[model samples]
Target: MAADKVPGMARIAVIGAGMGAMATAARLAVAGHRVVVYERAATYGGAVRRFERDGFAFDTGPGLLPLPAVYRDLFVKTGKQPLEECVELVQVDPSSRHLFADGTQMSLPNASRAGVVAALDEALGAGAGERWGDFLVRAREAWDRTRRPLLEEPLWPNWSVLADREPYPSVPHKKLLRTRRATTLAEVAAWELRDPRLTALLENHALAYGLDPRTAPAGAAVLPYMEHAFGTWYVRGGIGELARAMYERCLARRVEFRFDASVARIAEKNGRAAGVELDDGTVEDADFVVAGVAPGVLDGLVPGTALRGADEVPPQRGASSRLTVLLALRGGRPEEAAHRTVVHTPDREDELSRLFGERPGLPAAPTVTVSRPDDPALVPDAEHEAATLTVTVPSGLPVSESAVERVLGVAERALPGLRDRLLWHEVRTPADIAEATGVDGGAVPAPALAAADGRLLHPSNSTRVPGLFAVGGWAHPGGGLPHSGMSGALVAGLIVEGPEFRGSQ
Candidate 1:
């Protein structure tokens, strides 16, 4: 279907107020369209939000930010300097701390291969670091080769079509297809390394996806490359700075914003998208729409409109959901440092299940995060030091006040006197997150990119519905702030210049 033409200043309505929506609004505004952003929440920035209590502050999600260039490009498009003006991000060393089942520990540094290797050598044995290096080289090669071609491309129709257009084979695709998801990271590491401790350390990397190493993709086992190559960082004040920066850019480009507007329906006429219908029965006109919401949320908003064809349906989301506990600590959390401290118990997977029980919720003590020399903008410049502890629990967990106490009880076991030290604690169950952000199942996009018959992870960013696009974490290139931001760019390109237009030029 041809895109509807809007005279003088085109009206493009972007759904959601998260980073992806902001990015699209900024881009479209720069492209000579008058844009309007609709957000249901009181504030913007879906998962990457911040909260404060008793002079202490905490970022809700996406604590570790990388790939600053992605942010820089979006800012530049809006004639802003994100790096210089919006945030101050310091390169953090020791990207993470892994606490093993036996109380063994390992720390990872940003881009510090030698340091990580040395530490692994001390914790595990000689040459284990070197083995990891070999693994990373392969991952790097895959990352570098496919990042631009496959990752950034919108892959709804079929990957083969895109592959045919490319100049060469996709290394990332090749590697990813060969990876075994059911095989544990421990099994793969054992095959590559000698020491048991080294194997455990290698398996721990799968935690980034919130998956057990045993069942996570082998390609995921190479995630450490992102840390070493790009480095882990926190926005000067908090991750919310990134979202605010995007919002500022959108506003500068004249992107109109509507908050407290719950989108109830995506109006379609004759099997084509026309505009959106708000929950309050308000109708807005638009030539094109960018849906930055979770696909499931879209399913509810538009109903059967997402149906691509008689046989086509939106893909199924993974069952593994997430639980988060945000804490404002009066005193420091000594068990961990700046970025992350992942505590693994014996039979970690089973322990995780127990933590959540039959429902979704936080585990005992779980994983903790502490930021040092805390950024005052995130909180009031206060009299004492503060910390935020995030523990990932079961997704869709039935969280109650009593459940909150139980999780806190577990945290105390890991960090002595932690419960008493808390200035306040906020528990975010999946339902709460869903209510706050319009994420279906509280699963913020990031849908598992199922392989084409166990061969490739394919995710669709383009809706079968013409003139409509999908962006954000659950779409193409999968989740993470960088990839989600990029998804917006991909949809904008499709709208501004179709494939035919690109080929002709």
Candidate 2:
């Protein structure tokens, strides 16, 4: 239950107890505001959820955390205790091992550009590393140009420039007589990377996010640049531990959370957000409201209300979702095993065609990401281990046994004897993700990109309705653990400092 408001403070109603909403509430509370979060689910985290059974734990959504600094900033601004004090972060060495169908393999070192470049050259070929290294250089350029407006600041008033601009300096390629710079990530991969393996390496970054490299803007190069620069990390127990820590942080700040409470409507008064109405018809009034929900759900909250202007970027739709298979292995994890291995599909064309084809269907042999974390907390004992395998697929479809088998088969290349382990496995489909996201297809949102006609950007934090704002993946800066967390910071900055707030320092 929320406490009675103080005379001098404003009451803020935060819809959904997801990462972004919780982060926003904590910050707003520390800023001397009264905040309450209403979540339909019984838990705090949204897609950042955990599944536990028989002493085994697995993160049902994103298995790894990137850009830890985003949460570091939140911890610094919200309280005295830092994020590390809440959860342990283990930097993944050889960040990822890739097993290409062509019988080639390479391991990328964590956060070391030179190490990665060297490793690639040694494993892929002498000059393959140079190509990837060069790509990273250009990717960094995109990151530098987009870091501020795409992440730190609110969606700009003239966001068209961001939409129109392709920040990644894609190399030029000759078509007939004229030379044209690469406009799509596919062109960048083909013209710059050159080698099939290098192209797979580059495109996999975008593919992992459910983005199609063929059409994903060249500005999407920032995706790989981020991993190469910041590094990949795993929480001690699971990625869900990060969510637990953030939830605790919000609670520490006295931000009230009402779980299992469904918000039926976003109460509006005088053309401004007043508060929310629950499913039980109980209305909670507040000075402002922040919605951390899917676009479809948000629109239903206020019928016929124009929450966004025509010129503004619309909420992203039809993004790709994931299919996860949680595996329980009977043996202990190998001490020297890399934490993550990506099994590249043998036929990239067949995979992409099935995923983005006229009639989307499951790939016969899909690329699979296999994660085997070494954390003891995830297994019942040292003798047992847990692994998770994931594949990107079109959202909102029912998964079949064949789909799970295909994903498992692809992962077997990395595990060698994956099925022989004889341990049980659980499957998570788009239907499951839809439950958390509230999207029709359980489609996961991608981070706001600088190009692709602004099709990749999300709606701004400040909405068309006064005192009403959007937060989380559905809003500016877009999705992913770090981006969602950053959205909270952006929303807090806008609300606390008003329109003049550029961004957090």
Candidate 3:
């Protein structure tokens, strides 16, 4: 936790207790700055909350961690104790078990490129594995091109160039005597992978994040590459435990937290951010302010200020939300079961069309992600188990009772005799998420991607207003556990090292 103080340590204020905000708070405190965090909620970890009932606990947010290096770097920069010391981290052997439309099952090994290709080939056919392996090669190319700009570093001034350029080097396909390169993720699957099951498998990466493959940029291939390269990990207790560790890291670094403290607005002084004005009209002045909430919430806090330039990438809104069904099962978790299982929808086109088409509504056959962690921490005893089923749905839509039933039916593909083993189940709709994160419609933001005419990029961390900066899911690099953590590092660098900060050396 030892860090030299700058010329003069200044008082800094942070909004929210989300992972990104806490990461920034911990690092700033280590750098010898007086950091105070204000969270409107009674607890930390915004959407990364846990639901517990009758001795069964489940992470209501992200169930698995991808590219954990983001948080590892945060711990390294903040304190002497590594992230592993704070939380038990274990890699899920089989990254994921997928049940396709034809009842074909594929269990891909974690962090093994060769094993993944073999698994895909074994399940889908020899050519299926080779085609997917080829796609991964192209995906890695896209990751290499955009990794620094979209992630580690601050949003560049020439971000428009990133928006206009496609990082994915898709092979040109000859169609109707015309050559055309894949521009969208769906095209990538159709032209290159060339198998219906393979297309669904590749597009599932985007679907899991609520991004429609039909329009998601080809560079979005990096999503699966990230998981394939870094592997999927679990925090012993639950993913929520990572949030607890992060909050504790902040406290240990002398970062003060004000829970249940609401902020009304960002205080301004002579055209610069002065501090924060509380909901009760109390003003706490500081040298700089970092907001970690959604773009709309941040704009609301500064009613008169223009947060971004007219030409800057506009804040992405109303992507999609999830419907989660938490199950308390009467039987013990089978040791051989994979931690995560995805049951692909029977009809991909119909599912996508219904969810993201003209009139957005619940899909008749939604792809369901079933999580059955073999951890004693989630259950009362060895005789009981905890399981969660999740599927992306249109944000702001009313989730009917029948919709929940449909998702359960799809989940039965992953969990055999699901209803028979279920002791009780609780459903969480987007409205519940809206209540937790203050994001309208409970919509989750997708990670930023290159191309698609700047549609996927987020606003710069540094805003037009002096001494004001943005962090977390809604800012540059966009959402997800890893992206949000990286946003915190970028914001801290811009503040502590100035806007010229190029990122970690």
What TM-score, computed on C-alpha atoms, does each candidate reach? Answer: 0.85, 0.98, 0.98
Error of 2 at 129 (Å): 0.7
Tens digit of per-residue lDDT, candidate 2, span 1-505: 2121223478999999888998899999999999999999999898889999888999999999899999999999899999899999999998999999899988999999889889988998799888888899999999999999999999999999999999999887888999989989989988999999988888899989999999999999999889889999989999888899989888889999999999999998888788999999999999889999988899999899988878888889789999999999888898988899999988999888878777787888899999999999999999888999999999876799988887887888888787888489989999999987687798999999987888899999988888888999879999988899999998887787778889966
- The ten-residue window of minimal lDDT in model 2 covers 1-10
Candidate 3 residue runs with Cα over 4 Å from true position = 1-7
**Tell me, what's the RMSD of every candidate?**
4.9, 2.5, 2.4
- Indicate the worst ten consecutive residues by lDDT in candidate 3: 1-10
lDDT of each: 0.63, 0.89, 0.90
Candidate 2: C-alpha lDDT: 0.89
Off by over 4 Å in 1: 4-9, 160-186, 194-196, 310-313, 332-336, 352-373, 379-383, 400-416, 447-459, 500-505
Which pairs clash (backbone N, Cα, C closer than 3 Å) in model 1?
Answer: 94-109, 111-228, 184-214, 360-397, 446-473, 446-474
Report model 3's TM-score to 2 decimal places: 0.98
- For 320-402, candidate 3 gives per-residue lDDT tens digits of 99999999999888889999998998888888987788888776778999999989999999999899999999888788889
Error of 1 at 302 (Å): 2.5
When sorted by TM-score, best at the front, the candidate numbers are: 3, 2, 1
lDDT of 3 at 318: 61
